[model samples]
Target: MDPMKVEVKKIDELFRLDGYLKPFEREIRRRHGVLREWISKIDQLEGGMDTFSQGYKHYGLHFQQDNSVIAREWAPGAQQVYLTGDFSK
Candidate 1:
Protein backbone atom coordinates (compact mmCIF):
# COMPACT_ATOMS: atom_id res chain seq x y z
CA MET A 1 0.00 0.00 0.00
CA ASP A 2 2.91 2.33 0.65
CA PRO A 3 4.47 4.05 -2.38
CA MET A 4 7.99 3.55 -1.04
CA LYS A 5 7.34 -0.22 -0.89
CA VAL A 6 6.94 -0.35 -4.67
CA GLU A 7 10.67 -0.26 -5.47
CA VAL A 8 11.30 -3.67 -3.85
CA LYS A 9 8.55 -5.41 -5.81
CA LYS A 10 9.53 -3.65 -9.02
CA ILE A 11 13.15 -4.65 -8.58
CA ASP A 12 12.14 -8.27 -8.03
CA GLU A 13 9.98 -8.35 -11.16
CA LEU A 14 12.64 -6.60 -13.20
CA PHE A 15 15.29 -9.16 -12.30
CA ARG A 16 12.89 -12.01 -12.96
CA LEU A 17 12.10 -10.65 -16.38
CA ASP A 18 15.76 -10.35 -17.39
CA GLY A 19 17.43 -13.78 -17.28
CA TYR A 20 20.82 -12.39 -18.24
CA LEU A 21 20.82 -10.08 -15.19
CA LYS A 22 20.34 -12.98 -12.78
CA PRO A 23 24.06 -13.26 -12.18
CA PHE A 24 24.25 -9.62 -11.07
CA GLU A 25 20.90 -9.42 -9.31
CA ARG A 26 22.31 -8.92 -5.86
CA GLU A 27 24.78 -6.21 -6.87
CA ILE A 28 22.15 -4.52 -9.03
CA ARG A 29 19.69 -4.38 -6.12
CA ARG A 30 22.35 -2.99 -3.80
CA ARG A 31 23.29 -0.22 -6.23
CA HIS A 32 19.63 0.58 -6.88
CA GLY A 33 19.06 0.95 -3.14
CA VAL A 34 21.98 3.35 -2.82
CA LEU A 35 20.82 5.35 -5.85
CA ARG A 36 17.29 5.62 -4.44
CA GLU A 37 18.61 6.81 -1.07
CA TRP A 38 20.78 9.47 -2.71
CA ILE A 39 17.85 10.70 -4.83
CA SER A 40 15.71 10.98 -1.72
CA LYS A 41 18.37 13.04 0.07
CA ILE A 42 18.85 15.31 -2.92
CA ASP A 43 15.09 15.78 -3.27
CA GLN A 44 14.81 16.79 0.38
CA LEU A 45 17.76 19.18 0.25
CA GLU A 46 17.11 20.77 -3.18
CA GLY A 47 13.33 20.33 -3.44
CA GLY A 48 13.71 18.75 -6.90
CA MET A 49 16.29 17.33 -9.37
CA ASP A 50 16.18 20.34 -11.65
CA THR A 51 17.13 22.77 -8.86
CA PHE A 52 19.76 20.38 -7.51
CA SER A 53 21.50 20.15 -10.89
CA GLN A 54 21.51 23.90 -11.28
CA GLY A 55 24.04 24.10 -8.44
CA TYR A 56 26.81 23.54 -11.00
CA LYS A 57 26.15 27.02 -12.40
CA HIS A 58 27.52 28.63 -9.23
CA TYR A 59 31.14 27.58 -9.66
CA GLY A 60 33.68 27.43 -12.54
CA LEU A 61 35.10 29.73 -15.19
CA HIS A 62 32.82 32.29 -16.77
CA PHE A 63 33.31 34.73 -19.60
CA GLN A 64 32.37 38.40 -19.36
CA GLN A 65 31.20 40.92 -21.96
CA ASP A 66 34.43 42.93 -21.65
CA ASN A 67 36.46 40.20 -23.39
CA SER A 68 37.70 38.93 -20.07
CA VAL A 69 37.26 35.67 -18.17
CA ILE A 70 36.70 35.04 -14.48
CA ALA A 71 37.35 31.89 -12.54
CA ARG A 72 35.42 31.06 -9.41
CA GLU A 73 36.06 28.52 -6.68
CA TRP A 74 34.50 27.76 -3.32
CA ALA A 75 37.48 27.22 -1.08
CA PRO A 76 36.41 28.07 2.43
CA GLY A 77 39.67 27.01 4.08
CA ALA A 78 41.93 28.79 1.61
CA GLN A 79 42.86 32.40 2.32
CA GLN A 80 44.12 33.34 -1.11
CA VAL A 81 44.35 32.12 -4.70
CA TYR A 82 46.13 33.29 -7.82
CA LEU A 83 45.20 33.17 -11.50
CA THR A 84 47.88 33.05 -14.19
CA GLY A 85 46.94 33.01 -17.83
CA ASP A 86 46.60 35.13 -20.94
CA PHE A 87 43.17 36.72 -20.88
CA SER A 88 44.17 39.84 -22.76
CA LYS A 89 42.87 41.13 -26.03
Candidate 2:
Protein backbone atom coordinates (compact mmCIF):
# COMPACT_ATOMS: atom_id res chain seq x y z
CA MET A 1 0.00 0.00 0.00
CA ASP A 2 1.14 3.59 -0.58
CA PRO A 3 2.43 5.76 2.29
CA MET A 4 -0.40 8.21 1.64
CA LYS A 5 -2.94 5.40 2.02
CA VAL A 6 -1.43 4.45 5.37
CA GLU A 7 -1.56 8.08 6.47
CA VAL A 8 -5.24 8.34 5.48
CA LYS A 9 -6.05 5.17 7.44
CA LYS A 10 -4.17 6.52 10.48
CA ILE A 11 -6.12 9.78 10.39
CA ASP A 12 -9.42 7.93 9.98
CA GLU A 13 -8.70 5.75 13.00
CA LEU A 14 -7.74 8.79 15.08
CA PHE A 15 -11.01 10.53 14.17
CA ARG A 16 -13.06 7.44 15.11
CA LEU A 17 -11.24 7.12 18.41
CA ASP A 18 -11.94 10.77 19.14
CA GLY A 19 -15.63 10.22 18.35
CA TYR A 20 -15.80 7.38 20.88
CA LEU A 21 -13.80 9.28 23.51
CA LYS A 22 -15.97 12.40 23.28
CA PRO A 23 -18.97 10.81 25.02
CA PHE A 24 -16.76 8.96 27.49
CA GLU A 25 -15.00 12.17 28.49
CA ARG A 26 -18.25 14.15 28.54
CA GLU A 27 -19.77 11.69 31.04
CA ILE A 28 -16.65 11.84 33.22
CA ARG A 29 -16.67 15.65 33.16
CA ARG A 30 -20.39 15.73 33.81
CA ARG A 31 -19.98 13.48 36.86
CA HIS A 32 -16.70 14.96 38.18
CA GLY A 33 -16.22 18.36 36.53
CA VAL A 34 -12.49 17.67 36.23
CA LEU A 35 -11.66 20.18 33.50
CA ARG A 36 -8.64 21.49 35.40
CA GLU A 37 -7.31 18.01 36.13
CA TRP A 38 -7.66 16.98 32.50
CA ILE A 39 -6.02 20.24 31.35
CA SER A 40 -2.93 19.56 33.48
CA LYS A 41 -2.55 16.03 32.10
CA ILE A 42 -3.44 17.01 28.53
CA ASP A 43 -0.98 19.95 28.50
CA GLN A 44 1.91 17.47 28.15
CA LEU A 45 0.68 16.49 24.67
CA GLU A 46 1.65 18.79 21.80
CA GLY A 47 -1.35 20.61 20.27
CA GLY A 48 -3.75 18.85 22.66
CA MET A 49 -5.92 21.92 22.92
CA ASP A 50 -6.36 21.92 19.15
CA THR A 51 -7.45 18.29 19.31
CA PHE A 52 -10.66 19.13 21.17
CA SER A 53 -12.68 22.26 20.55
CA GLN A 54 -16.06 23.86 21.18
CA GLY A 55 -17.19 26.62 18.89
CA TYR A 56 -20.26 28.32 17.53
CA LYS A 57 -20.35 29.58 13.97
CA HIS A 58 -22.84 32.24 12.91
CA TYR A 59 -23.45 31.43 9.25
CA GLY A 60 -26.09 32.75 6.90
CA LEU A 61 -27.50 35.42 9.13
CA HIS A 62 -29.86 38.04 7.75
CA PHE A 63 -27.99 40.27 5.30
CA GLN A 64 -28.73 42.52 2.37
CA GLN A 65 -27.11 41.02 -0.76
CA ASP A 66 -23.82 39.92 0.87
CA ASN A 67 -22.32 37.06 -1.17
CA SER A 68 -18.96 38.19 0.19
CA VAL A 69 -18.49 36.61 3.60
CA ILE A 70 -16.16 38.62 5.76
CA ALA A 71 -14.13 35.81 7.28
CA ARG A 72 -12.07 36.84 10.26
CA GLU A 73 -9.67 34.56 12.05
CA TRP A 74 -8.33 35.59 15.44
CA ALA A 75 -4.70 34.56 15.10
CA PRO A 76 -2.11 37.15 16.08
CA GLY A 77 0.73 34.76 15.27
CA ALA A 78 -0.25 34.53 11.62
CA GLN A 79 1.95 36.55 9.27
CA GLN A 80 -0.05 35.90 6.11
CA VAL A 81 -3.09 33.82 5.21
CA TYR A 82 -5.34 33.51 2.19
CA LEU A 83 -8.81 32.11 1.62
CA THR A 84 -9.51 30.18 -1.58
CA GLY A 85 -12.80 28.36 -2.12
CA ASP A 86 -15.87 28.21 -4.35
CA PHE A 87 -17.62 30.58 -1.90
CA SER A 88 -14.75 33.06 -2.09
CA LYS A 89 -14.92 33.05 -5.89
Candidate 3:
Protein backbone atom coordinates (compact mmCIF):
# COMPACT_ATOMS: atom_id res chain seq x y z
CA MET A 1 0.00 0.00 0.00
CA ASP A 2 1.56 3.28 -1.09
CA PRO A 3 1.26 6.07 1.46
CA MET A 4 0.42 8.63 -1.20
CA LYS A 5 -2.36 6.64 -2.81
CA VAL A 6 -5.91 7.58 -1.84
CA GLU A 7 -8.62 4.99 -2.14
CA VAL A 8 -11.97 6.52 -2.99
CA LYS A 9 -15.15 4.60 -2.19
CA LYS A 10 -18.38 4.81 -4.16
CA ILE A 11 -20.87 7.43 -2.93
CA ASP A 12 -23.74 4.96 -3.35
CA GLU A 13 -22.29 2.86 -0.57
CA LEU A 14 -23.87 5.23 1.96
CA PHE A 15 -27.32 4.67 0.47
CA ARG A 16 -26.99 0.93 1.01
CA LEU A 17 -27.23 1.35 4.79
CA ASP A 18 -29.91 4.06 4.77
CA GLY A 19 -32.36 4.55 1.90
CA TYR A 20 -33.32 7.93 3.35
CA LEU A 21 -30.09 9.31 1.91
CA LYS A 22 -31.21 8.56 -1.64
CA PRO A 23 -32.90 11.94 -2.10
CA PHE A 24 -29.80 13.86 -1.08
CA GLU A 25 -27.46 11.91 -3.31
CA ARG A 26 -27.17 14.67 -5.88
CA GLU A 27 -26.15 17.30 -3.36
CA ILE A 28 -23.81 14.89 -1.63
CA ARG A 29 -22.12 14.09 -4.92
CA ARG A 30 -21.74 17.78 -5.75
CA ARG A 31 -20.07 18.44 -2.45
CA HIS A 32 -17.87 15.43 -2.94
CA GLY A 33 -16.84 16.71 -6.36
CA VAL A 34 -15.80 20.01 -4.82
CA LEU A 35 -13.80 18.19 -2.20
CA ARG A 36 -12.09 16.07 -4.84
CA GLU A 37 -11.20 19.19 -6.82
CA TRP A 38 -9.61 20.75 -3.77
CA ILE A 39 -7.64 17.61 -3.08
CA SER A 40 -6.41 17.44 -6.66
CA LYS A 41 -5.40 21.10 -6.56
CA ILE A 42 -3.45 20.54 -3.37
CA ASP A 43 -1.72 17.54 -4.91
CA GLN A 44 -0.66 19.45 -8.01
CA LEU A 45 0.33 22.69 -6.28
CA GLU A 46 1.94 21.35 -3.12
CA GLY A 47 3.50 18.07 -4.23
CA GLY A 48 0.76 15.97 -2.63
CA MET A 49 -1.81 15.88 0.17
CA ASP A 50 0.76 14.46 2.57
CA THR A 51 3.17 17.32 2.00
CA PHE A 52 0.44 19.96 1.95
CA SER A 53 -1.01 18.76 5.26
CA GLN A 54 2.36 18.88 6.95
CA GLY A 55 2.99 22.55 6.14
CA TYR A 56 3.54 23.41 9.80
CA LYS A 57 6.88 21.65 9.67
CA HIS A 58 8.13 24.03 6.98
CA TYR A 59 6.16 27.26 7.56
CA GLY A 60 6.61 28.20 11.19
CA LEU A 61 9.49 29.52 13.28
CA HIS A 62 12.76 27.61 13.08
CA PHE A 63 16.07 27.83 14.93
CA GLN A 64 19.43 27.88 13.20
CA GLN A 65 22.73 26.30 14.17
CA ASP A 66 24.23 29.75 14.79
CA ASN A 67 21.75 30.40 17.63
CA SER A 68 19.67 32.62 15.34
CA VAL A 69 15.88 32.36 15.14
CA ILE A 70 13.71 32.64 12.07
CA ALA A 71 9.99 33.30 12.08
CA ARG A 72 7.57 32.70 9.24
CA GLU A 73 3.87 33.29 8.78
CA TRP A 74 1.51 32.67 5.84
CA ALA A 75 -0.99 35.49 5.84
CA PRO A 76 -1.75 36.49 2.27
CA GLY A 77 -4.33 39.20 2.90
CA ALA A 78 -2.64 41.12 5.68
CA GLN A 79 -1.89 44.81 5.23
CA GLN A 80 0.53 44.79 8.12
CA VAL A 81 1.96 42.19 10.46
CA TYR A 82 3.60 42.16 13.86
CA LEU A 83 5.20 39.33 15.79
CA THR A 84 5.67 39.64 19.52
CA GLY A 85 7.28 37.41 22.09
CA ASP A 86 9.93 37.48 24.85
CA PHE A 87 12.47 37.63 22.06
CA SER A 88 10.70 40.55 20.41
CA LYS A 89 11.26 42.73 23.45
Residue lDDT tens for model 3, 1-89: 23224333665577788889888766676666677889889989889989998988878989899979788889989999998668752
TM-score of 1: 0.61
Clashing pairs in 1: none
Q: Name the 10 consecutive residues with the lowest summed lDDT in model 1.
A: 1-10
Selected candidate, larger lDDT, 1 vs 3: 3
lDDT of 1 by residue, 1-89 (tens): 33333355566677678878778766666776777888999999878798878766877887789967677787878988887777566
Cα-based lDDT for every prediction? 0.73, 0.47, 0.76
- TM-scores vs. true structure, each candidate: 0.61, 0.26, 0.70
- Candidate 2 residue runs with Cα over 4 Å from true position: 1-34, 37-55, 58-65, 86-89
Model 2 per-residue lDDT tens digits across residues 7-80 = 22244465576876554543443434345447656766533565433222422223347564445555568999
How high is the lDDT of residue 18 in model 1? Answer: 88
Q: Highest lDDT: which candidate?
A: 3
User: How many clashing residue pairs are found in candidate 2?
Assistant: 0
How far does residue 78 in candidate 3 sit from its true spot (Å)? 2.5
